[model samples]
Target: MKKFICIISAAVACIACESRTYEEISDNTPIAQVVTYNKDVKAIIDANCVSCHSPGPQALTNYSQVKGNINSIIDRISRANGDPQKMPQGGSLSPAQINIITKWKTDGLPEN
Candidate 1:
């Protein structure tokens, strides 16, 4: 019983020590320069997403695949509630990274 109590106490302590990382941005926040597949988009996806979605039949590791799924990509990265899952599952992208991606899409998912 005491061991169980100690484990519960430790779990509570860990939970209490955890901090929220989600940063809220105001509507007026300016976005960065246009992001392109070769320059920024690919790296961000590779670093955060391809691990799970790649080396598979529908890999997100290439331009064609990514271009085909641009809307879904943006939706997932932005952590939209509509998705069945939030990507980079255990972690999250920084607001800047998300901004880069959002801008990339708005800029038409350019190859450059």
Candidate 2:
């Protein structure tokens, strides 16, 4: 009975450790410094997204297109780590890369 109790307790603890809310996860996201399109965000997008989304029908080849679709960009990237329709279809961006884009949108996406 004691062994069973210990195993159950360990299982519950593991579940608790894994069950982080989205707010908790976002709060722990790495913060980037002064993210800008030219200096940062563009590279992240070019490397991860533009391959399939650029110079094509759903283009993100330039600043205007990205800035215009900022909401969708945020949503897609935020969920990309595990979502079925995640952006960058084959792989996931690092937290820092995602943070840079998120910061750019939050900072109003400066041209510099």
Per-residue CA lDDT of model 2 for 51-101, tens digit only, reads: 888686689999989888888888877784668877778677666677788
The runs of at least 3 residues in candidate 2 whose Cα sits more than 4 Å from the true structure, single-residue gaps closed, are 1-32
User: Compared to the true structure, candidate 1 yields what TM-score?
Assistant: 0.67
Candidate 1 residues 3-112, lDDT tens each?
A: 99999999999999977545654243556576789998889889988988878775898998888988877777777544557777877777778888788888888998
**Candidate 1, which segments miss by more than 4 Å at Cα?**
1-29, 80-84
The CA lDDT of each predicted structure is: 0.80, 0.79
The 10 consecutive residues of candidate 2 with the worst lDDT sum are: 21-30
Location of the lowest summed lDDT over 10 successive residues in candidate 1: 20-29
